[model samples]
Target: MIITRCLRPSFLAKPRLPPLSGCRQFWGWLNAVFNRVDYERIKDVGPDRAASEWLLRCGAKVRYEGFDKWQYDYNGLPTGPLGKYKIQAIDATESCIMSRGFDHLDGLEHLEELKLCQCIYIEDTCLERISKTDNLQKSLRRLEIISCGNVTDKGVISLHSLRNLEFLLLRDLPGIQKKEMILELLQKSIPPLQIELDLKD
Candidate 1:
């Protein structure tokens, strides 16, 4: 926000001040030059805004908190902050995070780690949506689905497309009855995924 004043004595002879006219021109030029850049950091309003804000307030330099569409890729690693302040991880443990709510996930392209611990609302369909995220295929490295009672083998298998995943934690999930399918596909995979499972009865 810059304010500039121009003085034009000759134009002041008329009813309107020529100085004000020049000031308006300068303001217009300023807007034209920087209209595209986001000068003010906006605090977005959304369901996940609280979560994102919590992270930021706790010294997490996160710019966006999600529940939108997969606009960016799951970037960075387990804990290190990335180049951009985009969402790098999601912790929906015991939260209201659900399967149908994944429409918002499409916007979280920079998400890397996702924790759905005790999220009873999520199901295999959520994994289906996760698999579709372009960034998940390239950037997502860690996925944790613990005690999500609705997820099954089919849903767990849906994550097979996340090729870059390095760690997968599935514990206390009674929904995933057949663990072999998941283990066979990911445990000894090309990237050698590190996994933790407790599907046994």
Candidate 2:
């Protein structure tokens, strides 16, 4: 009697994926959680505090009104009165903030400066959302978008909605062509808005 051993078919074997594949998925989920907007939380704590929690959780830094130091550490955030710490500036360098989470910017009445650097997920829609935010359009003055590859002239031009914007800085945005034309258009739309660009000619 000859006994034959059944061999597993190669097609049934699992393909090797990158070792960090699971890590990538974990990070993606974590970022989503961090970016989640709790409208109730916003109402209960006010937009500044709620937005502070979101930004800090997503690895961004925020400076509150009348504060010279940036608040970055998630655990070390101020325990002072919630409404007292109105967010005045946001520096989201290398942070995971995406357009879906920008509802936090909706009611920021005092936000004057914003910096988005190396924010891999930022795109035209993100800028569009910012442009359309009523409070931001009225109060935001200084803006910086650096090393965010997805931003293009369309996104940059959407800043026209920010009627009060005073300054804009663009650097290393490979997606922006006709840099000169974009500059001209932005200056024309917002006459008081000064712009600085480091995009390659």
Candidate 3:
């Protein structure tokens, strides 16, 4: 009697991966796709709509102008009139938004409040970009940045451009050095702005 064993070919065998590796890869790919900026789509749907789509796709929530309920689901996005529904507030906690996608916020004249929490991709350049935006500088009122480790004093100080900003809240930002000095500068630059911080020296 001859014993024969069947062995799977190396090429056909599945590669071993660490726990949640596949899931991580999938999420990374999805985030990359969500962050992609399509200029044609922006021109077609308008900046608010395009920005809303991007925010929703990246696990962020948006509150439309005059709407109390937040729009979080990508599939359930409001569809009535393109320019009618303007973005009023954005909650981009743990979202995949990067500096490249900042262009989507250019023409959002009604945007009032923006919260960025645990957004690992946010950096000084991103803050500088939004701070310099003419529309955001005029319209934005409240801004909250929490646990965004990449934000530093340079980025925080650049927010002085938001001349109309009424409130600023910052928490758990390890990158921000000279928090007291930054706060003083902010106070001097924007006299009416109120800032709240939970930072360590």
Candidate 4:
């Protein structure tokens, strides 16, 4: 799997390319001779605006950690007709959003691991969308939500649908007051699935 890294704009410009003419010539010549590099390194080439476009063009596994917002173009995420997807992990911790963060991600049929840390606005509704994904019961294995204050029993209940899930981690969420209740629900939902529960006030 090709790993594409997106760097900040300030950092991209610092690389000090020789000039557009040199870059164009080098790329033109390289393309003619080689099979094309699987990994394309991009820095601040355009707003995150072009990020989705590039993902489609390359068809490579992505690790995008920073974006201006929590919501992204739905078309960019892997979905049906696109065949198996290959995003190993996504860390959208501090990004901005009003509600659930997984609605647009329903198409990622091959997503194995997901992380939402410090996304304060994420709630049960977001988790509901994630649970509804196709083959999610069999595809997803690990899920982690930390410091998401709005998450509660409703969200925890939604997670019960992940039948094939192996690891679940929840921490510092004020809404889940009854730790025992949460544990009971999980035990009943997917009794054989291993879980890691943490509630420290």
Give the clashing pairs for model 2. none
lDDT of 4 by residue, 162-198 (tens): 9888889887777887778878888898887777767
Please give the CA lDDT of all the candidate structures: 0.62, 0.92, 0.92, 0.59
For candidate 4, what is the TM-score? 0.57
Which runs of model 2 end up more than 4 angstroms from their true locations?
A: 1-23
TM-score (C-alpha, index-matched) for candidate 2 = 0.88
Q: What is the lDDT of residue 180 in candidate 4?
A: 85
Summing lDDT over every window of 10 consecutive residues in candidate 2, give the lowest-scoring window: 76-85
Model 3, position 127: C-alpha lDDT score: 98
Candidate 3 Cα deviation (angstroms), residue 45: 1.3
lDDT digits (tens) for residues 25-98 of candidate 2? 88888888888999999999989989998999999999988989999998988887768888999999999998
C-alpha RMSD in Å of predicted model 4 compared with the true structure? 17.5
- TM-scores of all predicted structures: 0.58, 0.88, 0.88, 0.57
lDDT of 3 by residue, 95-157 (tens): 999888898999899999999999988999999999999999999999999999999989998
Which regions of candidate 3 deviate over 4 angstroms?
Answer: 1-14, 18-30
Model 4 ranges with Cα > 4 A deviation: 1-85, 97-101
